[model samples]
Target: MNTDSTRRWLALGALAVAMLTIGLDMTVLTVALPTLAVDLNANNGALQWFSTSYTLALAAVMLPAGALGDRYGRKKILLAALVLFGVASLACAFAATAGQLIAARVVLGVAAAAMMPLSLAVLPVLFASPVERARATNIWITSTALGLPLGPILGGWLIDNFWWGSVFLINVPMVVLGAVAVAGLVPESRNPDLRPLDLPGTVLSVVGMLGVTYGFIRLGDEGWGNGLGWGALIAGAIVLMLFLGWQRRTAFPLIDLGLFASRGFRWGAVFAVLITFGLFGLFFTVPQYYQAVLGTDALGSGLRLLPMIGGLLVGSRLGDRLLPKLGARLMVAAGLVALALGLGLGALTSIGTEYWFTAVWIGLVGAGMGLGLPVSMAVAMDDLEVARAGMGSALLQALRQAAGTIAVALLGTVLATVYRSELGDLNVDPINDSVNSGVAVAKSTGEAGMLEHVQSAFVSGMGAMLWVCAAISAVAVALALWVLPRRSAAVGADEAVPAVFADVDAPESTHVG
Candidate 1:
């Protein structure tokens, strides 16, 4: 390979490392939640915030972050985001309270918001060949996918061997490496036509997302009788409607409504959101099931997730090879089928369910995610023009992040409601709060029946949540088959190639300097 080719690939590696950090932070908190609940004296609401705060911030800031990258320089914005990510990770490590950690996670989310879009934007800038770009994109997607499952595994081991804070500390070295490599290897690129930042749209999106997410979380904790939850949910929905109206009228919109015009972008985005909804639900519940229900340590909880990772790797490999032949529609549909099957099996989980059974269903879920997510993203991305890459990718990321935030909130509500119902008027606040607390109460009271009841209630709640996820996946499968394009656009002389693979055969001069 030539020197330029080597550098370009190396640059992609650095970007992937940065992407991995963002993905790791997404689910790393799942295994840590049980620990945080005890160490930080956090309640169920606080536990939900620990995850949503980060994702909410990501959804809120991503659009502006993309605009910033486009108006400024992608490499410079990316480097700054990387440095801030490292700093935020440090803050998360030493947080003295749950509130502090939640705040730190918000900062980390903002930094990641910048990193996610800008790093993707750099791909078109680096690789001019269509085939090479497709290959590079797959590698990039795999790195991020790997981090989701790996987060629990790595965080669990760290929490077990060292401290709960070690999970956050682990990101420091990776951030440093990504930052140094990015600074040295990546070239700067920006849009010459400055896109005005939509301050009103940004504020509206942030507030609306927070309000809706908090409402769902509040409802979960306080139940349906709480007026605050209902009020917040209604108000949030109204505000989001207003935000959409504003976007349509505004000269400089935070989200480009026009992008939805493309059939590929619209349906690709829908499938992506559905997949994330199920994926986050799994990550949120499984760790607690492993630790609190099955009585495993954090490390053991993480290790148990390995089957899912294996299935994901296998599915991703197959998807990459088959996507060209099967086309986005069939490829995505196949993945959703696997996902629904896995979730359907998972819905049958009981307190006495065997580990092997759990592994089989969980692995299937992973495979389904692996097969669907990348193709969905690629199809959406394929619709973006080179000039709109930053904003377009950010728009997609925002949607996915927003869906994740809502998923955790909604699924958590489902889990808590089912758990409380199964327990049947416990009258004990600690026991009703969460399975972790219920377990603590059972242990303290030395009641074997109480322990059994707590486990049974939690398992029932998990099963209910999985059923909801499976239904969503099934719906997604039908929609994907109906909506996505049947085949990739042909690449031929005198024909316009898909934007993702456009200029693949172009000269090196086509790349941004």
Candidate 2:
């Protein structure tokens, strides 16, 4: 309530805005896809690439980015990354072709790889106590969560009222002012004993991540039969194996694999992965079912998700308060149960199913994720040395994001497969030709009945993915219960905000004491 407190909250607010930009980019781009395809004369594969490329690049560099931030400084890297992100956004606004947009977005993703987690890692240090750190994290999670769903509403408004470029242009002022606010208000911290960048480790990890992502995406298109998909995946695994080997031997590893030796840290990563799988996967699928099967417009489709959104807002707020009271075990377990129940319930939806029927189920899914995300994340870094927090959170976040993308690709592919199988006499070429135009062609070809079947397949695939999410959340819960010390022993571990990431991977650069 005093001036010092006011300044700290103001700093958190600025960081929240930074977090919002990252989530908004993900959702907003989806909303603008139709416009993008038409204006740029893009095909379905190209449109998919728009998102896929950014995701791929983001995942590939996350570990390295955090370390880079740490070795240099979280604040310096963060500000620099923000500047580049804004510039890239401006470029994306004027992107003349699909390739150009993809290029700039890839850059934006690189910047986001740095920005998103750093915001979380950085802001908590501003608050003095463990409770204050928890409260700050609660705010960060809520803002980031809201940004994803809010994107459609905001992007739709921009696209309808102005131009597609307006979406990217919106980031300009946020980035400019965000840089200024953070520089002035945020204290810089770094590992006092920072090491030089681990060049070989960085190269290996990036290649491995890029390969894995490309393989999954290619498989979505060409099936596992495609040699490229299988080859990239195999080679990617090998590269990643090599990267892990390097991590173990190197004096300065990109990620300290040793950290996972703690049961709590390992499970925390699992919890992160599970939440993204269920949350973003459902977020990706439901809107299509709404528009394609139920006949809602884009705006209506976006709005239909409000129940889940409402639940997210409510549950994230409540989860923060409950973590201290319940400890990690009960909270994460309960959240997983809610998530599985919601997804399993959603699997029952069929051709032309009622919205409200699924609404309750979807609401459960959102609420459950809200519970898992914050605590699981906080738990991972709870007991870590301050120097290691950046790498830990970045590692956790990258894994979570990868899980979401894989679910999207896997579920999307599964739906595509099932739709095709049940597609008896539908125009396969049209659907395969372009994601954006497929529905129009399907309608014209007397395949309207098939729409429901495809929708059902997608919902079914989502349920399957949810089962995977449940398993992972359970793993995370186990880690939290076992790895973290007993609740009565010490809660200070929970209170210590992960500055390694803020300070993004490598800790001292961004945070200062």
Candidate 3:
């Protein structure tokens, strides 16, 4: 291969590694959640935190880290992130207690914060033309999306046959190979005019995010009736106000507050958050319905989700095709409507429902996600000047993860509440006793009524959670319409463009601090 061809191909491969790591980390731990809860002797709420901790930390750090990449070097940040991620994965694999595992997940999230946005932004830097850039981005999105949903399938198989830690252990070789490729092939680059880190804005953003996320998680366990839960939700909103004010005052903001002025960026962020809320939240519940109710194993549950994954691919391809034609506005709105319809149908699903039938509905959800995610992301970044691409990508990534965290936690609480209410009020004593002592004895011994009641309660509660997802998705349609208009960047490229992300049509230029 010629020098240019060699560099581009190598960079793509390195980026592939980053995408794989990120996609895998998201769903793999989810499959293992039940196992961790049982083995660590932790409660459902604690299990919820295991997921929340990682997402919260990841969301909190993403913007700050993205700025760091622009200020320092992406290659440097990417490589360091891989190393930390690998080590954290190993630590999680060996963790003997829930606390240890949650701590490890937190570390993993911090490391992963760089891998997502940096990888996305790096693609434009690698390819030289709009056509080439578009193609490269397509491949990146396809591979990453494929990897993300497959994490459950992969984890299911590993956990069903091997061990919970195996899910995490899988990252080891990928990281090793990825790190080597990135070190050797990815050249160092940065925006020379990167402003100082937006510390106040970062703090406020983190706090706001954590508040809302924690509140949702609490709902999973405590329900909205809990004062602490409502307080947290309200606090998150208040902190968000502070964060916005800080952004306005900062000379060099963590996020270019100006990017939101772009119709594409604003709508894209809205769609990104909504998409995660629908898909990730849906993914969390399906496995339980499969294994807990349908009596399928981990592998079977994930394999059953194959239709949704397929839908995602179709939707993604379709969205890509429609993007340049429709621009972002109509495409995202259509995608949101599709997602809402799918989730609305999915909520009606119940135990003993035909497996094949469920697949079709799942496909609808998947297709909606497929169309919404990449379409919005492409739109958000479409107007980005060369210099601000990294920051733009980071903000988008943080928004996506934040949305995912909120979805899982809030949905979790909703599910818990519905289940309990369905049971006519459940107590832990009966559940623990029956499941632990033996079903037959509990039935013969008088626990049958309570046991059946709780199980029914769980089913009902799960149904309620699904409805909430549907409503949120429906609301997203309005959000998309309002936030994502058809317009160019509110601030033109002149002031925002940093030296590094020069247009492909321009002479090839590299920047150094």
For model 1, the superposed segments whose C-alpha errors exceed 4 Å read: 1-13, 123-142, 184-187, 321-327, 381-390, 489-513
RMSD, candidate 2, Å = 4.7
At residue 204, give the lDDT of candidate 3. 88
Clash pairs (backbone) in predicted model 1: 129-504, 130-504
lDDT tens digits, residue span 138-202, model 1: 67765775676688888988998998999999899998999999888888888787868899999
Lowest-sum lDDT 10-residue window in model 3: 499-508
Question: Candidate 2 residues 342-455, lDDT tens each?
Answer: 777776677657889878988988788766665666667665777666556566666666665566665555544544444455436655433335565556667755555445
Compute each candidate's TM-score over C-alphas: 0.89, 0.82, 0.84
Off by over 4 Å in 3: 1-4, 120-136, 320-330, 378-390, 429-452, 475-513
Superposed by TM-score, candidate 1 places the C-alpha of residue 474 at a distance from the truth, in angstroms, of: 2.5
Q: In model 1, how large is the Cα lDDT of residue 475?
A: 87
- lDDT score of residue 6 within candidate 1: 86
Q: How far off is residue 58 in model 1, in Å?
A: 1.5
- Per-candidate alpha-carbon RMSD to the true structure: 4.7, 4.7, 5.8
